[model samples]
Target: MTDSLHDIPAVVNREGGALDGPNSLVDARVPAPIAPSGFDLLIDVRAVSVNPVDVKIRASANGNGTDRILGWDASGVVLAAGGDTHLFRPGDEVYYAGSLDRSGSYASQQLVDERIVGRKPRTLSHAEAAALPLTGITAWESLFDKLQLTGGSNGALLVIGAAGGVGSILIQLVKALTDVTVIATASRAESRAWVEQLGADIVLDHTNPDLARQILEVAPGGVDYAFTSQSRGRMALFTQVVRPFGQIVAIDDGRDLDFSALKDKSISWHWELMFTRPRYGWNLEAQHELLNSIADMVDAGRIRSTLTRVLSPLDATRLREAHAIIETGRAIGKVVVAAER
Candidate 1:
């Protein structure tokens, strides 16, 4: 660490419990990261996007009297690169949904592995690029990796909670890369419009008690695949609307889900968590490639950023506000916090 790297500004959760409004996030300074080694890149964080995982972790954190930084989706410039780092060098602009085991992007600087980082899209500002990584990766993994969708495959896909971050990008990827027809569900009129704008062929009101019936009416034989952001208590809906032997990919923790319901239809259920790659060190480089593909699609105008709101100055108060917006569960797309100019 250089002399100028002694202190770095950050927003952290001092006490790990339920959110107490603004007090839940506190402004602080942490020591500069140790010199980058191996595949690490020391980054000057330019912007960060808030995700539901950040809200969940903040609400259930246990810092043990230590400050815990909570952020994952970030876009930044590389300040320094480790000896083994080949994909990026100092001054390279990059974006990534960083690993959960490390201190996160809620700071002036962060240390991330290069294997999970991608060149930031040239057409987007730092804030816009920041919004893509986490949700984009989740959506990509759910479609291509879990649901096994391909460009040649032609079928209907049901997207539950289609107005939020993951669904916003998921809908776009499906339109851009596959022949699948999208039947997205949203309760609010604005959400329906948002999904349609993202390329949903049909939009259904998820709040409707007869949602499964409505889905079946649209895609009569049942959807070929289902992607649900909120899967708790919705297994029965998936069973009712998904075709026999179809697959369902979910991001939520639906521990109470009854797998037996799907037995009759032989419906396969898959859980997609973007963190799984870095968390267990499984095929880590795949995220790097995935983000690069997303960036290419974005630059090619095949996909667009999901950033819907931005808060300025990257302070504790702004982070708290972002958290509050996510907690409401009504965020139309992604909310970002940018560094002060």
Candidate 2:
């Protein structure tokens, strides 16, 4: 079915700027997407979560003047499915971190590939489930794909910025799936408590200049794996605290990282971006499988949604508010916005 004129509600960023700018993020009505084909599923978006990517993109240069719809994590119901889609039906509830190449989930409706989508956790609300996909996929990939961790693996893992979305979920995934000891860093008391509650075995203040000494006190020799959500100025720290031949994985876009610092210890550095799969079509179904696993874990009570805040009636204003919160780099857990009132 075709949409009525300007029927789909969306929040678009035009000429990216600071949150206070006139066009940073604004309410608009766009035409609904066409019928699903191939592996596509047309979704009636129920809830979406704000991530660091959204904030970064919103502040980027918009030289082309395209109105960008910036969102990744979403929980929704399938409204229709393409002929080749075998995983879901019209009424199935699902969640996914959609491709960065397409219009994202900050809208009333969206079209996503079934390969990157999964059944939503039955026990969680849409707002809660909305907080999982992007961060969940990232954490899963970082542990299994990048760090090459398995269920029987036993080692100490140091998580930097452990109170944010990915780190919060990462800690839980590690604790549930492996026997690793988690040493997480959080600069604030509430953030420290949040990570600890999520299963961190040890917590350290990220602001402390003597962090390496504290980590060494716990791990003795050094940590076996280090995951940093923000890796801008911490490469040297990882080089010092990660054991010889240990692994370091990061999700940041810091280009000034010095790889030379890691050579003396034979340390390996890896980068994880959840969009890499959908963006490259590299084993896209892996995300579908991993997300399903995460959902099962959530349903079994081994995992919990990290959703900590909810903003209602998804609109440009609320989206801008969410972006501002993320930009501060101090948000604990996840923040979601419900598409409907």
Candidate 3:
């Protein structure tokens, strides 16, 4: 099986193409990625996922860039390994959120660091696995590392933007590992139901002005901790709902939040970036270890994959359609494009 990794890279965008950003459509061609050292894993990408970063970078590109591939999530087979690679050789079916600083998994063959990749969960198809990596990392880090929610904190958790990519996965992880009551905010009927089904104990509408009131209506008292996967527009409201000294972790960098509001409550704020470990080249193996743990959870049925829609044959047209849907801010789960069939 390891010998099968020798296959030549098939997907190429020789002219350095572009896609519509974050909620837009982009169609362009670029060059195939090159395998580098220390972290040499060439994935024969079978399926890929669109994240918020993909949308943002595409929207910002002015056609003057050269090496700007912006996909982060993928499920694929390893085509080649660097000389020092040991975690996985070749021909392994894997899923990963590749590095932020490098070209990403949008192409058919992607070069990735071995530390960041994990064997695809046994139960899911390529498309399903593609959706897990980025959101999974963000949710895992937000709940456990940043918020310190795992150390037997027998309390309630409020999750903002409960229907988005990271929130969807966060709800499930909290349900699986901890006894915390999961409270999530969703504005739409479908989104409300989606979070509840995903494992949120209670759902609130974020668009409503009476968020604090509504939360108190459900929990009666303030929440023990909060996780905000949505935008930063509601920092004030979040401060209101969190108990004194309660922890608040947000994955998105919110806008000009005055920490003064939180001072009264002694609330702690944490920022979670999934790319931190890989982006700065620190504790890289921890990524491999963390993802492998997720694999076990997924296989045990403790956590489920979050893939919602899957398109066929990675191309500019289908990629554009997926990007367009994501930009609308209505996509409930992750969308993926398969490079083959």
Candidate 4:
């Protein structure tokens, strides 16, 4: 902490409870953020993007009963670096999905590990840059790391909830890096078009009761991989539609799922949580490297930002509205709130 939290205003979840009420999140102040002694950088936060995790965290704050800042993805300029910091300097433009253990990017400034931060994509504004980190990391790890895809797999992929932020980027990455055929699930007309534009080879109405049959009609035997961006009851259906030895990956915290259904078919199930690296200090620099590569791809036009909505000068009111939009499960991509310069 830099200055006392009581000294500066910020949006916060002072009392974790249901977001249905106005008091669920409110205008509050947090201690001015400060970089620790080493391995961290202090940033002047300029923009932030919301994720479903924000809503969950707000609704389940630590039982200690103290308020906490709520943001994970942000783009900003570095203002200070710890004594041991080597990757960045004051005035550097950066973006990152911050660690789960620290103060977040919902304030005027924040502290972030330099190892997990990346140079902002040259072609994007702070608002656009903020939208990429969390989802970018999640999508990258979920596809390549968990699925172990090294390109030219010639496999077919089925993306459940394919119009969301992670799915949007995953589709682009699959299209850009491999010959894999992509079948994306999108229920709405606009979302269907969105995934198609992002390079999904086929689009199916995930709302259909016979979604597996629909995918099989187009994919022949079954898809070689399944990325379940959103599913619960549908896991069984996925097991039925995936080819033997197929891979199933997910970014969500799926509960009540039994892996036994995939036993005979030899399916491999993997879970991806982008926060794992930063939280445990495990290969933390991977985020920095991956973000840079993604930025390069963005500059080269092989990939694009998934930002779909923007609000200005982040505040509790605007944040609450963003939360509502996310909870409704209708947001097509990332929703951002940028501070006016």
Better of 3 and 4 by TM-score: 4
Give the Å error, residue 171, model 2: 0.5
lDDT of 1: 0.92
Per-candidate Cα lDDT values, in order, are 0.92, 0.93, 0.80, 0.88
Distance from true location, Cα of 72 in model 3, Å = 0.4
Residues 295-328, candidate 4, lDDT per residue (tens digit)?
9999898999999999986888888888888989
Clashes of 4: 2
Name the lDDT value of residue 6 in candidate 1. Answer: 87
Candidate 3 residue runs with Cα over 4 Å from true position? 1-31, 62-64
Q: Per-residue lDDT of 1-341 in model 1, one digit per residue for the tens?
A: 22354888889887756677544788888888889999999999999999999998887857476778889999999999999999999999999999999999999999999999999999999999999999999999999999888999889999999999999999999999989999999999899899999999999998899998899998899999999988888888988999999999999987878899999999999999999999999999999999999999999999999999989999988988898899999999999999953
Q: Pairing residues by index, what is the TM-score of model 1? A: 0.97
Clash pairs detected, candidate 1: none
**Cα RMSD (Å) between model 3 and the true structure?**
4.2
Candidate 2 matches the true fold with a TM-score of: 0.97
Per TM-score, what order, best first?
2, 1, 4, 3
